[model samples]
Target: MRDVTIIGGGFSGTALAAHLLEQLPGGARLRLLNAGAPLARGLAYGTQSPLHLLNVPAARMAWHPERPTDFVDWLRAQGRPAAEKSFVPRSWYGEYLGARLQEAVRRRPDVAWEHQVARITRLAPHAGGWTLFDAQGARAESQDVVLALGHFAPADPHPDLAALASPRYVRDPWEPDACAGLDRDAPVAIIGAGLTMLDLLVSLDHAGHRGPVLCLSRRGIAPLPHRDNELQPPAYDTPDDWLSGSDVRAWVRALRDAARQLQAPQDWRDLWVAMRARTPALWQRLPLPERRRFLRHLQVYWDVHRHRAAPSAMATVQRLQAEGRLRLQAGRLQGVQDAGAELALQWKPRGQDALQTLAVRRIFNCTGPSSRLSQDRSGLFPALAADGRLLPCPLGLGLLTDADYHLLDAQGRPQRGLRYVGPLLRAQHWEATAVPELRQHALHLARALARGHAPAD
Candidate 1:
């Protein structure tokens, strides 16, 4: 009997586990491990607030691609009517994930599936298999293992903010009760102006926070809102001569020109979806220098367009802006210091010669997940790197992996039985973050593991 273990109970981990159950032969056993994150929800879907909606439409979120409308069907079965194009509450999607996992377990009772709530710190090779050491001094073994650790925490770039150990400072927005103790009447400042920043804004509104909100980032641009209309495939082909250039500036111009041809920003969304479908191919064709240049200059602009916000949530942000309750600043954080109930912030605005200061009751780090594994304080990656079990991508975006999702060792050789499937694949595939991309990886990995393809070494 083959034994397998998956660490992390988030969307990637849970989907992989469910697919594995169906693919593995009888008598094989599997274990699913999770620690602090809610089962099947992870950080993205852990929010219970009604305002936190899935950025993608309901029809495309099925764990099984063969059943493309499974999520919408599930909603109807539960007496909740939902359309294929509707953006539903994230909490409801979390419920769908939980139900799918339960169904997978129910169908394969002979597999001896189990869920363990524990945090893993280290992994070691043992007798042609692997042993995991959890936080409580417990150990578990499996013939094969997959590390679906999802996204890592954001890096604290500022030295002063990183040194603080006060209640007024929140390093992670997903932490339990992050905004619970905040003073409603006192102003709050957020360190990033991205998707996470938007989520926090919705949360504050739900809690009835009436104080002014401050948003600071190197680029003060928030993500554009998704259009309510259905998006169609590209109507015309973007000629090779038009987009064959390697310069990022020219590429941006080409996209804007294509959007203008469609005659509406709403049509731009469809154009974006088509471009995203080919992003991996386009990214792979570029040289390493060009990729680096794009990351440094155009990544933020691409992000704001690619990953959009829900219409209702976008409306909330617009409302806040109209009332002058929200402010966006483009600058770099210079320092932060404690000042009684409030914290003082110093920043140097872009294209300016002077520093600015502000005091706020609380500050949140919403810079999104840090892509560099070397900067991760977590013990998992460090241990793997120390033992030559894993190698960092050349761009430092994530773990280096081959085309088959097998992680690379320190010497840059693919290590079988040690697989990965999540946003970390961004280093190789530029569009790996969203569910549509991740589900393909999960299905392919599951099929490979079922065929007894794991390497003994």
Candidate 2:
């Protein structure tokens, strides 16, 4: 039996595997199953576009916290030295992760490590562990299973929009050749205004598409850009007393008050960073009603500020906007229809009484990952839910997991020997998506598994 079977090979899975290999006992066998993106370069970092850059600076992106400069050190050794504060292309980061995984494997030849490209569709409880089945009828038994399944593609925002399924309507912008075959000068519509939309803008520019690109979302607020010198961490006064409350409005008021007192406008970014360490606790403190209120009202604003883009990428967006090649608008997309030779998008502009139509040659859903598990088309999650092996969060954010990241079952019992670590932990920890937070999760989970705390029945 496999000592540990990891169900995804994205960053979270790869990082956990590397850590486990370093800590697991000799003679232990580990298996990594990926649905076919490269082992380390998952959807986020697998882009081939050189213009797609890491939002975080190089100094802070290392997978292992103990070796904070591991990424930078690797870059230097590759003869491609980058400043500690520079935002490097994401592909390079993917290469770095691949190298790290290989190093971990090479360093521990005593442990058996195997990676297979398989799409896991279901998991069955067997002999106190799990019997995992892939799409090909193959099966594997493990003493412990870790679900590091990364982000799923965005769900169709509107029911009507889903019905108009044509090649012109791109469901996932990350898919290869997503923008292929588009006329160079034809207008395009993107269904989001967040970091993913910004990435699409960069991609469009890289592809030499000079057509006007319209980005539409409910709020139409784009992500803020990072400061050029992000290396110097700013000072922000922490309001510990104010943060103890469970009221969302009170928390927002405190944040706004603190923002007003920032030494400089850029210091607001630092203020957000200062609040990062406390977000998960604050989120947990709130009653479910208050959490729902925050999601309904404040999530967009919080996302724009918390998840800022690289200055270079934002600069490209601004340049395109200034050139009349890009446009950002606040609106709700109502529906889509076939317009002769083009697709017509019907949307209601923010604060407008009347709907308007925009015809574009192509429309891409640049909206980020789907948060609702009910909309998950992947057979894996639905199967898990049906078997009472997994429980979806009450808020519909992600799966429910305990403090140690053990997945909770339908009856709210923590499933021993079964765990998860990824953005889905957002169900419990509001700020669990990024690399910094995920790396920590990976490390903690790895340490627990290595300690043999989760024994097979």
Candidate 3:
């Protein structure tokens, strides 16, 4: 039997595998299953666009926590010198991660490592551990399983629009040639105004599409830009009761008051960094109602401030807006209709009852991944939920997992030998998605598995 099986060879899985290699018992067998994406790259880093850059700087993006400058050092070794704080193309980082994983594997021949290009459709628990099956009926048994499934495709925003199945509609922007065959001068509409929207904008510009573009979202707030030289803010002193309070509104007020005390406006970013480290604890302290309140009212505003964009990419977007080639508006999509040569989009501007229509040759869904587990079309999740093997979070954020990352079942029991790592951990830990957080989870989970501390199967 395989000692450990990681289903999803993205950055999370790859990083976990590397960490496992260091901690797994002698002569253990390990298996990694990926659904045809390049190992270590995954959707977030798989982009070939030169303009798609890392939101974080090189120095802080090292896969190994022990070597903080690994990524930056890799850049120099590749003859592509980058400063510690430079935001480089994401493809380069993908390459760096892939190379590091390969080096780790080569250094450890005692562990049997295997990677399969297959998607796990179902999982069955057995006396030995768990049996994971692919669509083709192949199966593998492992004592432990880690679901590093990363992000899912964006869910259909509207039933009617999704039913149309028109060629003009682009459901997955990350798909190859998603922007191909577009009329260079025809107008286009992007359905969200977050980081994905910014990437799509850069892609359109790269493809020489100069047509008018419309970005529609509820808040219409684009991500703030990172400073070229990010200054480290002074250490923030947290009050003893900060995490003890259950009131999200109170926490917001406290944060705002603290931001006001910052010596410089840019220091707010550093303050956010310090606060981010404690977000998971703070989130847990919130009652369910307060958590919902934060999501409904403050999520967008928090995202814009927390997840800033690369300065260069933001500059390009600003340039396009200044030239009237791109427009950002706060609105709600009402419907879409085929208008002979183009698609007519009906939307109501924020705070206005009058409906407005815009004609566009193409519509791209840049709303990012679908977080609601109930909306997950992936058969694996629904099947697991049906079997009482996993439970979706009550707030529809993601799956419910315990402190050790063991998936909690329908009856609130942690499943032995089953684990998860990735963005979905946001269900329990609100700040779990980024590299710094995910890497720590991967490392901790690896050490736990290696120590054989999980409950017996």
lDDT-sorted candidate list, best first: 2, 3, 1
TM-scores for every predicted model: 0.94, 0.96, 0.96
lDDT (10s digit) by residue, model 3, range 161-213:
78655458989888878888998998999999999999999998989999999
- The candidate maximizing lDDT is 2
Question: Per-candidate RMSD vs. true structure?
Answer: 2.5, 2.0, 2.2
As a TM-score, model 1 comes out at 0.94
Better of 1 and 3 by lDDT: 3
**What are the clashing pairs of model 3?**
none
Q: Write the per-residue lDDT of candidate 1 for residues 255-277, one digit (tens) a residue.
A: 88887788543477776776776
**TM-score winner, 1 or 2:** 2
Local distance difference test scores for all models? 0.84, 0.88, 0.86
User: Cα lDDT of model 3 overall?
Assistant: 0.86
CA displacement after TM-score superposition, residue 252 of candidate 2 (Å): 1.2
